[model samples]
Target: MKNIKIILGLVFLTISSIGFISCEGDDSGPATVDGPPVINRVTLAINDSTTTVGLRENMYRIYGENLATTKEIYFNDTKSYFNPTLVTNTTILVSIPKETPYFDASDELKVVTSEGVAVIDFPIEQPAPEIDSFSPVAAGAGEIVTIVGSIFEGLESVRFGETEAVIVSSTSTEIQVEVPEGIVQSYIFVETLGGVTQSEQAFGFKFVIYDDALKEGWWVGGWDGSEDFENTEQVKRGDFSIKRIYNGGYSGFQIGNGGAPLPISDYSAVKVSIYGEQNVGNLRFSINALNEQELGVILQVEEGQWNDFEISLDDPALIGENELEVFSQIVIQELSGNSNVIIYIDDLGLI
Candidate 1:
């Protein structure tokens, strides 16, 4: 046979060339190798500004292949659907889903991977500035108020009730604070970042009351230190007068040109007018400020019969003296013995 039929055709071509090299070494084994997964880098984190409105927690990272099988993530156009968890298929841990109720300031974030999607462009700031209404509703300690409505731009503080107000100027709407001196009817809060806004009503400032008829040569005397007293000659019939008789026991009334020195500051308070008879015993009318070494209670003439007395000099060394030498005494140390009471002293001004 022709050499055994050419040795069976060379052994059937060496068994079909060893089954074509074992199907090319099992198709170059390594599990069907396809390639395409070296993404190297991608990261993002959020919160530069998003002043409240709803869910907004972002964090993402992807460094290559199977990125833990990333699912989806997109911000701005909103859409984050993730469930990835594969720290080393080539790292991937994304979670950004909770921000959708309006309040986007130019947002941009994306990361969807089956092999595609990856973007980042964050910038969503703005929302931190609020304080509305405040304009002379009543401010008096030192006054200087003006804080009117809506976002004032980063303005950090402006408080008055607890103290700390002296902004002076700012604008986005308005701000001019200064009312800080133990504010009494308080309520004025204005901090920024869009949180803390108070003052819809409640503001007060203004207090200073010191009075006692104008002084400068104030005259009216008679108690031996005579300027020749005669308010109709200390009446004793029809007007009932005694001129000056403070019966605490020591007696009263003595201001004389004979002593000549009475100007006692332009006045802070002191006004007298009295007429009493019923055996008066509790009569007091004092105003002695000869430079005040401490002794100024001013006026108090009470025994019931005719009354009109106003005295007040809040005590500050008896206020602005040019010559200051006031004196209008009366108060008989609660009459101890010798029943004799009758009072009458009129006008005597300096307020």
Candidate 2:
């Protein structure tokens, strides 16, 4: 009887030892044995050693153990997005949530698994700024421009082309700044603690208009060849201006020095200011010699407000010797056949 009892005890001990061995050998066995997930390090997805704080809406990796079974992740209680297929037992790949609603980063990263939740102290950052649009899309230096976008909470710098601008005010959605000097037709750039962002569209430079030039050495004559227009104090910009009275039909005017041509070589475009009590349709202006080589743009002048017309001199064929003074004639034509139209013109010059 004693011998039989000893044999049974040995068998029971053998079974227990085999069970322990099996549990140790199988890595996918039970969650209790694996404890909880541990986050060793957080790094940019592109570089493992670059430990810069993660930016919102950007990708990053969390290296540690038992991350493959992670069910949820949070950056300071702000839930982040991750892919289960991308998670491995040793590392987890995730994208910081873009709409985190926080201006700054959080203090800790939380990871939850079926076994339990684990947290490691780390930083998650705010998203970079995004631009929707800006007002006065074209302006000269020292002019104030409004920039509309998201995440303008903390602005480090605003640049026009390569030149930095003077920031007047900033908010979550809008930024008001002075146009920087030496700015060309270049995109705007904004930077913050999160990162830098650039505008896809460029801001154009407004040409400097000479009001005095219009008062002297400039006359208007076209097919109608009438002198009904007069220089008036009602100016859109500077103190001097011209007012024209239209009495129906396709009428036009030629601007020159005593019926002679003027040179315009150093300028990029012609800027015109117009105001009328009624809408003017199909209005066009052209430079001398380039009329057939380059066509001007159509203008739809709204009533009761000042409107600007920018005609580009982009045609290389239009360039002439001593362009600043050689422009033979600048003619503005109204093809809409409107009757008794009163138009106010101001600030006509090279830009």
Candidate 3:
């Protein structure tokens, strides 16, 4: 009986040992995860490492290891939305909220994973201003030019080369500024809290003619002597410009101040600054000569803004060099279809 009991005890101890080993060595159960997420670098998702500073509401990528289990992300303590499909073992794609507070130094990016959480200090900043394009690329002083770009928030000022432009209106992505005096064909500049940005291409300005409204060289007629035209203070430059409203009575409204004929000896072209009610086109400009060979140039003026029309004197389609030299009257006939069309003229001169 003692020998049998010993054999049974040995067998029971062996079985108990096997059970313990099965539980400890089994790979079918939940596996132990390794290290926490490691962040190597952060870069723009569009252009890669070109910019380390992430733009608000723009997509960015975080490169690291062990990120597949990422659960959440935060920018400056504000939770950022991330897509599961964009999260992988080595990268996490996220969109920085547009409302994320900018210029915060203590901002950090947090990544929570199943294994552990990781953090990296980051800075949230407004993207520097950028200028994609501007309207009326060439205009005289006091004419409004619209600037379109990104990150115009907190716009401080605008610059035309070295001259400062007056801000008309500013938003997150657009700015309207009047061309300041003394601006040449130079780069358009913009300043904001983020930084200053300049146009890659240069803009132009037209030469001055009758920019001052108080000038006495204008002789406007053809409509009844009623207030058809006036040298009003609504000028694009100094003080005044000629504003005309056609009441559809005259065959064409005439503009001539009876001043001495302007010599086109040193000039190659004539430019006029014009603004109309709405998208008026096909304005006919005639240069009359004592020789009876009239030259014509057509101008297409945009609506609701100042437009500069330049007519080349040497263009074969317009006039001869001799006719341009002896031109007497600069006639502008309003054929813009609007019956009661309103137009503003400034800086009508030879360039």
The number of the candidate with the highest TM-score is 2
The candidate maximizing lDDT is 3
Candidate 1, lDDT over the whole model: 0.50
* Residue-wise C-alpha lDDT for candidate 2, range 1-351, written one tens digit per residue: 999999999999999999999977654544342768888888888766657466667788888887667899998688887888777777788888866555554577899987778787766665788999998877656779999999887789999878889999999889999986545357899898768999987776343333534535555566652433435545664455666656666677666655334334555566677776553666666666344554445667887787876566664434333244555567666768886566777766655
Instruction: State the lDDT of candidate 1 residue by residue for 294-321, as single tens digits.
Output: 3334333455555654455444434334
Q: Name the TM-score of candidate 2.
A: 0.49
How many clashes (backbone N, Cα, C below 3 Å) per candidate? Answer: 19, 10, 5
Compute each candidate's TM-score over C-alphas. Answer: 0.24, 0.49, 0.39
Better of 1 and 2 by TM-score: 2
What is each predicted model's overall lDDT from 0 to 1? 0.50, 0.70, 0.70
Superior by lDDT: candidate 2 or candidate 3: 3
Which is the better candidate, 2 or 3, if ranked by TM-score?
2
User: Considering only N, C-alpha and C atoms within 3 Å, which residue pairs clash in candidate 3?
Assistant: 213-240, 218-257, 219-256, 219-257, 279-303
| Candidate achieving higher lDDT, 1 or 2 | 2
